[model samples]
Structures are given as C-alpha cells and as structure tokens.
Target: MSGTIAFGLFAVVFVTSALSGVFGMAGGLILLWFLLLALPATTAIVVHGVIQLCANGSRAWFSRHYIDWRIVAFIASGGALAALGLALIDYTPNTAVVSLLIGLMPVLVWIPKAWFRFDASRPHHALSCGVVAGGLTIAAGVSGPTIDLFFIRTQMDRRQVVATKAAVQVISHSIKIVFYLHAALVLSKGQWGMVLLAIPFAILGTRSGNAILRRLTDANFRYWTRWIVTAIGVFYFLQGLWMVT
Candidate 1:
C-alpha cells in the first residue's frame, strides 16, 4: 500500500470505531467498503475482520457490565457451526455481492413488530441470529445490520444491545480471520504493520464514542441508529448496482 493510502486507512479506523462505539452498527459496514477499495475481496474481508475484532473487542470490554452471557453463548455456538459449514465450502467473497447483501440488511430493522419479531433473549432466536449473522459476516464482510435486527426490538437497553453485539462480533470476526487467513498472506510486512498501527486509533475512537453513548437516551440511540444504517445501506446498494452494470 502507498504511504498516503496507509495513512488514510488509519484515519478511517479511528473514525469508524468511534461511530460503532456510539451506535454499535454502521461503522463496520463503512470500514469494509473502504478496505475493499484497496484490497481484493477476500483480502479485504480478512483485513476488515482483524480491524473490527479490535474495535468490537474493546467495545465489548468497555460495556462488559451490560453483556448478556447467556445470549452470547447461544449465538456464538450457532455462529461457530455456521463458520465451520462455510469454511468447508472454501467460500470466496465477491465485492458486488457483499455490497448488495449488506445494503439489503438494513431492511431488517424496519420490519414491523407484528410482521416478525426477533429478540436475542430468546434462546431459539439468539441461535438463529448467530447462524444468519455469522454466515453474513463471512459472505458479506459485515453483519452489523443483521445483528441489529435481533437486538433492536428486544427489551434490552442500548448499552445492553451494544455490549452484546460487540461480544458477538468479536467471536464472529475471529472465525472470519481464520477462514480467510490465506488470502491475507498476500499483504507485505509493511502493509501488515500499517494494519496493526491502526489498532491504537481504533481503541481511542472506541473510548471516545463510548463517552457519547453514555449521554444518549434510549430513544435517541435507536432513532439515530436506524437512520444512519439506512443511509449507508442505500449508498452501498447503489454502489453494488453500479458495479453490476
């Protein structure tokens, strides 16, 4: 990677981490898009997983008090199973397909409660969330939107939702890195260094966003999350369509 692009990536890591810290969504979607610009589809997905692992790891720790262990365990079990199945297939990501999947994912949050309900607190629902979200994470490089659908309507407050999602992503991202580790071997040592250098920024940004999260009312938090993700999804969907044409 060029020094200029490397520097830009670090900046993105910080900014998007901060964004995710606040809403616990959208940031990964944006970060994956940026990575895809500079790397191949599989390589970009691997890099994104590594970076997001850091971001979500710290976020989960920051909100550890609110994490629902039962929910995490259930979802993680499903996610692991899903990852194993995908790994056996030797899945390869396609950029346009990733964009389209991510773009369509935001629609989940808009579904009416009467039409379909998802609550992570329910064991069955949580397991289903894990399978769908884990598969999406590997196939599309980001599953924040699909994950949100399970948590958003739950009785859990914003902090609970953010913390639990972070923990889930941390686990899911680990599987993603291992699944695509070979593709990531193409990066030069210097490029890997650049990727690692983004970590501190990711941590700092997470801290900054957490500070803001403390101030948001549950109502405001959900309201903003929905709109931000929808806006991003529209952009990604358009980008995907353009790529196809």
Candidate 2:
C-alpha cells in the first residue's frame, strides 16, 4: 500500500477502536469502511478481525467479571458457522441490501432496547443470536449492531452489556481470523506494518474509552450505541452503492 493509504488505515484503526470503547460496537464497523477503501475485501476482513480481537479481548478481560457467558456461546456458535461458510463461498453482498438492513437494524432494535427497557432479566436465547451474529460478522467485517440488538432486547446493565458484547465479539472475530489464516490470504509487508502500528493506538483508544465510560449514565450509553449503529449502517449502505456503481 502507498504511504497515504497506510496513514489512512492507521488513523481509522486508532479512532474507531476508541469509538468502540465509548459506543460499545461502532468502532469495528467504522474501521471496516476504511479498510474496504484501503485494502482488498478479504484482506480487510481478516486484518480488521485480528485488530479487533486484541482490542476487544483486552476490554473483555478488563471487565471480566461482568460478562454474560451464555450470550457469548450463542453468538460464537453462529459466528463459527458463518466464518466456515464464508471461507468456502465468494459472494459479495449487495451494498444497497446491506445498507437497508443497517438502517433498519437500529430502528428495529435500538428503539426497543432503549425505550422499552429490556434488561438482563429476560431469557437469553444465545444460540439464536450467536448464529445470526456469526453469519453476519463473516459476511461483513462489523456486525455489532446485529448482536447488539439481541443484548439490547435483554437490557442488561451497562457493564454487563458492554463487557459481554466484547467477550462475544472476541470469540466471533477469533474464529473468523483463524479461518482467514487457514485460507492463506496474502498480506504485504507494508500492510503488516500498518496493522501492527495501529494496534497500539487501538489500545490507547480502548483505554480512553474505558475512562470515559465511567462517567456515562445508562441512558447515555444506550443512545450512543443507537446512534453509532445507525450511522455505520448508513455508511455501509452508501458504500455498497458506490461499489456497484
């Protein structure tokens, strides 16, 4: 990649990772956009997956006690199945289709999660959510909104929601990365260097996000998640259109 592209990727990884800390899941999707522009789709998916694995793993561990493992299992199973299928297929999603889904996901889940007050008390149908999240994450580098909706419906406490989501993503992304590695997607030296450099910034962003997280109210976090997911969905929709055009 050119120096300009390298710088762009670094900037994206750093900024988005920080955003995820504050917003719960948008950071990965934001990074996905930059990567799509900066690298090949397959390369972008794996590289972003690896970076997110590190960033979210740390977040999961930092708030280890707060995780809801049941949800993690559901999401992971779906993710694993999806990743396996992705490795075998070669279909590109219709950008317009994805864009519409992205726009609707927030409207469908966020409004309910935020306004209706769905907490952790509801039964967690982990396998169902996991399968959906896993498949989507494999097809799209960031599918946090899909999984976030599942959690939102449950309305767990802020910490539980954030920490559990991180844990779930870690498992989901880890599976995707493993599939990519086994498939032998090529990475240039420049690409590797840029990805490595971005790791530290991603870390810094997560730390800053965690600190900022302490000051947020439950309502604020919900709103932030809603806004970020909606924004990312719109972005993907537009990106798909650009690709087809």
Candidate 3:
C-alpha cells in the first residue's frame, strides 16, 4: 500500500473505533462502509472483522468488570449455531447485498420499545439475539444496531451496556473472521500489513472514545446513537441502490 492509502486506512480505523467506544456500534458500520468501497464483499467483511475484533476486545477488557458472563455464554451459543448454518449453506453476500443489509440495520434501532420487548438479560431473548444478530453480522459486516435493540431498553446502565455489547461483538467478530477466512487469504502481504498496522490505531481510537463515553448521559447516548445510525443507514441504503442500478 502507498503511504497515503495506508494513512487513510489507519485514520478510518481510529475514528471508527472511537465512535464505537462511545456509541458502541456506529464506528463499525461506518468502517465497513469505507472498506466496501475498496475491497470485495467477503474480503472487506473479513478485514472489518479483524479490525473490530481488536477494537471490541480492548473495549471489553477495559470494561471487564461490567461484563455479564451468563449473557455472553448464551448469546455465543446462538451465534455459533447461526455460523454453522451459514457455513453449511455456503453463503456469501455480494457487495450490493451487504450494503443494503447494512443500510437497513438502522431501522432496528428505531423500533419503539413497546413494539417489541427484547431483553438481553433473559436467556431466550439473548439466545435469539445471538442467532439473529450473529447471522446479520456475518451477512452485513456489522450488527450493532440490531444488538443494541436488545440491551438499550434493559435496566443495565450505559456502562454495562457498552461493556457487555463490546464483549458480545468480540465473539461475533471472531466468528466473522473464521467464516470469511478464505476470502481474507486472497489479500497480498502489503494489504495484510496495512491491516496489521491499523490494529494499534483501532485500539487507540477505542481508548479515546471511552474517554468521551464517560461524559455522556444515558439519555444523550441513546439519542445520538439513534440519529447518527439512521443518517448513516440512509446514505448506505442510497449507495446500495445506486450499486444495484
């Protein structure tokens, strides 16, 4: 990769990591959007999984005390089931499909809490979230908005929500990496180097976003998260439409 391209990738990682650190999902959505512009569908999703694995792992570690292990275990099992099903079917989303799926993700966040009572704390609900969100993550390259629907309305405060979701995403991203490993191997050494170099920036960006996260109230966090994701979804949906045309 040229120095300019390398720098651009690093910058996107940092910025998106930071965004995730705060809202816990938008950054990955944005990062995947940027990646899809430069790489093949599966390749971009794998690269995105690698970067997000770092970001979510560090974010989970930073807030380890807040993680709910029971929820994690339940959701992971569901995610695994979804992965197995997808792998067996040998599914691979095209760029336009991925973009359209991602673009539609924001709508999950907009659903009124009264419309669908999804509590991530419950075993069945969490498991369902795992299957649905996990499948979406693999297909679309990001599932934050979908995952958020389960946690945001629960009694858990913002800290617990972020930490637990980060932990969930860490596992989810790992599954994505494995699912798309073959596609990722097609990358050249130089491209892989760019991805490796971008890791530190991802971690750093998470740290920076965490710092800002402390200041936001629960209400503000939810408010901004909804609008920001909705705006991004609109743009992505349009892009997907254009691609299809």
The 0-to-1 C-alpha lDDT of every candidate, in the order given, reads 0.93, 0.72, 0.93
Residues 1-245, candidate 3, lDDT per residue (tens digit)? Answer: 67987888999999999999999889998899888878989999999999999999999999899999999998888999999999999998898998899889889988987899999999999999999999999988889989999998799988899999999999999999999999988999989999999999999999999999999999999999999999999998999999999
- How far out, in Å, is residue 189 in model 2? 2.6
- Over the stretch 122-172, how does candidate 1's per-residue lDDT look in tens digits? 999999999999999999988998898899889999999999999999999
User: What TM-score goes with each of the models?
Assistant: 0.98, 0.85, 0.98
TM-score attained by model 2: 0.85
Judged by lDDT relative to the true structure, which candidate is superior, 1 or 2? 1
Selected candidate, larger TM-score, 1 vs 2: 1
Query: How far out, in Å, is residue 179 in model 1?
Result: 0.9
lDDT of 2: 0.72
Q: What would the TM-score be for candidate 3 when compared with the true structure?
A: 0.98
